[model samples]
Target: MKLDILAIGAHPDDVELSCAGTLIKETTKGKRVGVVDLTQGELGTRGNAETRTEEARQAAEIMGLAMRQNLKFRDGFFQNDEAHQLEIIKLIRKYQPEIVFCNAIHDRHIDHSKGSQLVGDACFLSGLRKIETIDDSKSQEVWRPKHVYHYIQWYDITPDVVVDISGYINQKVEAVKAYKTQFFDPTNKEPKTPISSQNFLDSVTYRARDLGRIIGVDHAEGFTVERYAAVDSIFDLI
Candidate 1:
């Protein structure tokens, strides 16, 4: 199925923490959205890979995503190489999304930056007819998304665009909390990680509020673009 947007991340909950509000907003406007996680997050401090996978599924349901898939790449060691690019390329062609949202260009986690570049590169390569891919015993056609935007993660990067997600912030929180094995939960007896702190959970809300304050909105999500973004009219900018 053709998707309006495909949000990809290095780990399962990355998209939920960073851009699920934007996805929720878009989908509410009748846009079809999907999510692709590059890794299962086996190396995360709090949860096992199997638990993370279940969490991802729960989050997908909460977000009402059209599709959710994991590439099963090594948690901390995946590279932005040909093999990795090819895997992403196949998904791009299969989904044929118009816009792709990926992990931040740089982040605290090494895999986030690598996955960002890997997916970005694959988006470009997917358009080349020479770089062939196959699906379901049939040769797939080349398909490139019109744009790619990287959502801000651990480090706040200046965004070329900010999406107003004030009304959907609660949905984003719910989606992130679906990963019960990862986030701040006092009830759970698991060892605490960086994300398991109450402050980290608060940051998710505060970060969006901060971004929104900059743009005169109640809450917002930030994104950096690789190339110039165009609009039909200046009034489109808010």
Candidate 2:
């Protein structure tokens, strides 16, 4: 199905951690939003692949996503070669989204930056008519999303734009909590990691709040853009 906005992450909970608030806010406005995870996060310290998949499904429902898919690329080892780019290109064409949200340009995890460039390159290549691709044996048309934005993840990159998600913070929190195995959970009996700490869980909300404070809003999500963000009038800046 055609999507208004498509959010792509290197792993399962990456989208929830960074852009869930924006996705929730968009869906509330009657937009068709979808998610594409490049990896299953199989290399995570705590949860296994099967459990992560189930958690992602629950999170999708919580966010009211129109579509949710996992590319199943190797968690930390996926490369940005032709093979990988082609896979991402197929999704870009299939969804034909107007806006695309991808992994942070720079982050603590190596996969984040790699996934950013992979998706960015794929979005561009997907628009080339000669790059032939097919789905279900039928030739697919080329498509390019109008905008590609990178959401902040593990790093505090300066944002090109900040989206006010005041009313959707609760939904974002709930969607993130769906991944009970990945985040802080005292009873999981799983080995603790950097993200498994209560401090990290609190950072998600505090980060949003911090961004919101800078923009005079209750809550907000930050994103870095490929180019200068412009609007038809000065009134567009809030």
Candidate 3:
């Protein structure tokens, strides 16, 4: 099915932590939104790959997503090579989403930056008519999203645009909390990690609040653009 927006993350919960608010807001408008996880977060200290997969499923349900898929790329070691690009390109052709939200340009995790560049490259290469790809049994057509944006996570990168998700903040928080093993869980006696902390968990919601405060909204999610975001009329921006 054609998607209005497709959000991709290096790890299962990356999209929830960074851009769930924006995604929840979109789905409420009856937009066809989907997610593609490049990795299952197999290397995380707290949860196993199986657990991460289940969490992703629950999170997708909370966000009202149209579909979710995992490419099963190597968790901390995936590369920005032709093989990986072709995989992402196939999905781009299959769904033909108008916009894509990808990992930040720079982040604490090496995979985040790698994923950001990889996805950006895939989006560009997907537009080239000569780059052949196949889906199911039939050859797929060349397709490229019109806009690609990078969602801010871990590191506080300045945003080119901030989406006001005031009314959707509660649902956003719920979607993020679905990843019980990945985030702040007092009962999860497995081990402590950067994200398992209560403060880190709070950051997801607080970060949205902080961004929202700057723009006079109750909640917001920020994204950096590949190029200038355009509006036919200046009033449309408001």
Show model 3 residue runs off by greater than 4 Å: none
Question: After aligning candidate 3 to the native by TM-score, how far in Å is the CA of 140 from where it should be?
Answer: 1.0
Q: Using Cα atoms with residue i matched to residue i, what is each candidate's TM-score against the true structure?
A: 0.98, 0.98, 0.98
Which residue runs does candidate 1 get wrong by more than 4 Å? none
Error of 2 at 167 (Å): 1.0
Ranking by lDDT: 2, 3, 1
lDDT of each: 0.94, 0.95, 0.94
* Candidate 3 local lDDT, 1-238, one digit each (tens): 9999999999999999899989988999999999999999999998899999999999999999999999999999999999999999999999999999999999999999999999999999999999999889899999989999999998999999999999998898898889998888878889799888989888878888999999998989999999998899989986
The C-alpha stretches of model 2 lying farther than 4 A from their native spots are none
Ten contiguous residues with the weakest lDDT in model 1? 185-194
Which pairs of residues clash in candidate 1, taking residues 3 or more apart in a chain or in different chains?
none
Clashing pairs in 2: none
Candidate 1, 123-236: lDDT as tens digits: 999999999889998999999999999999999799999999989999999999999989888998988888999999999999999999999989999999999899999998
